[model samples]
Target: MYTLYYIAGIATIISFVSNKEKTIQGLKVGWKKFSKILGTYLKLLIILSFILLISDQFIINYLGGQAPFVGLILGLIIGSITMMPGFIAYPLAGILVSRGVNYMVVAAFITTLMLVGVATYPVEKEFFGIKATIWRNIAGFLISALIALATGILYGEVLI
Candidate 1:
């Protein structure tokens, strides 16, 4: 939050100094553009956000207390399919950890949360060329899987 505020302040100052009149006009244009985008995505965002919330809580309360290896697999499966933002995963993972879920499983889930987002595929392909984005995302997903597996296993050993 602080970083975002600082960046916004800096950008505003820079624009004001660069050309005050132009900056004011640009700010108006930018707001309109952003508002339009928010309006367009509002429904989809609400639906997806709800789904994420339900899924995370379900996983934490139900699947999280199982054996570490089983929980890891479940976490990976959930992470791959979940469209929730990575930012929300941290607290969810913490909750699962408190519920007796292994840290390694949570780590794997967090890794997948950031690396493999099925929901972002269409936009990612459009922005970054289909083949390039798919390959990169796949590679990232694989690396995240490996990291989660290794870290979870290590954490399980240490904590146990």
Candidate 2:
């Protein structure tokens, strides 16, 4: 982490020395683009925090391997509802696993988070038509479920 910062700083310095004007221009453009997404990222962070907090409690209290099917259902529901970038989703999945979330549940959550598009349905429907978009999402949801089961089998969490 610190190494990345150091490398970036050194590279920036070299870039500035090689072409100060171009470096400044690039930095300005990058900052502008990053700033636009920063607010959205912050909002997602808050939402993820609340979800993890609630889920941690639930997992510790009741979900404990005893109700894997219910946990997987919750995972699928939450993942389908929430739209987030993979950068955030991956880390969130790791945190959930560390918090005692079942591998199958985490797999279902991560798979659906990337594949299913409940939150983006409006935009997809506008471009692809309602029927096509709806069918595609349905197919993707089924595929995600399969992937989750595969992940479980690979992890030795599921038999046969």
Candidate 3:
């Protein structure tokens, strides 16, 4: 992350020197766009923090091998509603697996973690509009479920 900041700083310096006017214009535009979405981003953060606070135990118990279908459903909902980035999501999924959570549930969580984003809907809607965002999320959830089921069947049968 620091390296990325360093690289970006260097690039910005180069761009600014090469064309000061263009660089200034670009920065102004970028800042404007960022400011416009700042409120939405903050709201997302607050909501996610609260959800995580309440969900940790509930998710573990529910997905830790209750009913496979229920686990999958819960996984889909959790994955969709949370905005966990890949770096955190993958390691967390691994921990759940090690703790004996169903593989199907983990798979569903991971799939939707990457594909769906109910929590980020505000940002997505800004770019894609409400109808498109809704459809995309729905499609992503269904596809993630299908992938999870296939993964469970293939891995469970083959490895066992």
Candidate 4:
């Protein structure tokens, strides 16, 4: 983050030196765009944080001692719906696994976390259209489920 800030500062300085008028205009445009979406961004952040908190509690309370299939389904749903960065998701999954969560569940969560993006569907639809985005998400979910199943078998968590 600091590195990014440093790079941005340097770039801003260069921009200002190259063309002060353009730099000011660009900054104004950027600020306007950021401000336009600030409310949406805040809402997303608050909703995501609340969902994550509730989901964690729910998982801790009910996911344990449940069947692997149940865990798989729950994981798929959570992973598909939740929008978290990989850095946060991976570490959180690891911590859950260390706390004795089902390996298959973790596998599904990780796979879908990487492949599926339900929360980003609006953006994806903007780029790829509604049909393509839907199909892509469906394919991603199926593939992630398969990968999770394979992981469970390979890890000896599921017998043939």
> Which candidate gets the maximum TM-score versus the true structure?
3
lDDT per residue (tens digit) for residues 9-105 in model 4: 9999999999999999999999998887676567666766666765565655454566999988888888888777788878878777878888888
- Evaluate all candidate structures by whole-model CA lDDT and list the values in order: 0.73, 0.76, 0.84, 0.82
Q: Runs in model 2 with CA error above 4 Å? A: 1-66
Show where candidate 1 strays beyond 4 Å: 1-47, 53-55, 85-87, 156-160
Please, what is the TM-score per model? 0.64, 0.60, 0.80, 0.77
Residue-wise lDDT of candidate 1 within 17-128, one digit each (tens)? 9899999998999999888666436655665766566655677764577676777777777776676655677777778778877777787777877787566665566557
Cα error, residue 2 of model 3, in Å, equals 2.6
Query: Considering only N, C-alpha and C atoms within 3 Å, which residue pairs clash in candidate 2?
Result: none
Worst window of 10 by summed lDDT in candidate 3? 151-160
Lowest-sum lDDT 10-residue window in model 2? 55-64
Q: Write the per-residue lDDT of candidate 3 for residues 46-96, one digit (tens) a residue.
A: 777775675555667767876777888888888777776689888888889
Better model by TM-score, 1 or 2? 1
On the 0 to 100 scale, the lDDT of residue 106 in model 2 is 89
After superposition, the stretches of candidate 3 with alpha carbons farther than 4 Å from their true spots are 13-20, 54-57, 156-160
Model 1 clash pairs are 104-152
- Order the candidates by lDDT, highest first: 3, 4, 2, 1
Rank ordering of all candidates by TM-score, starting from the highest? 3, 4, 1, 2
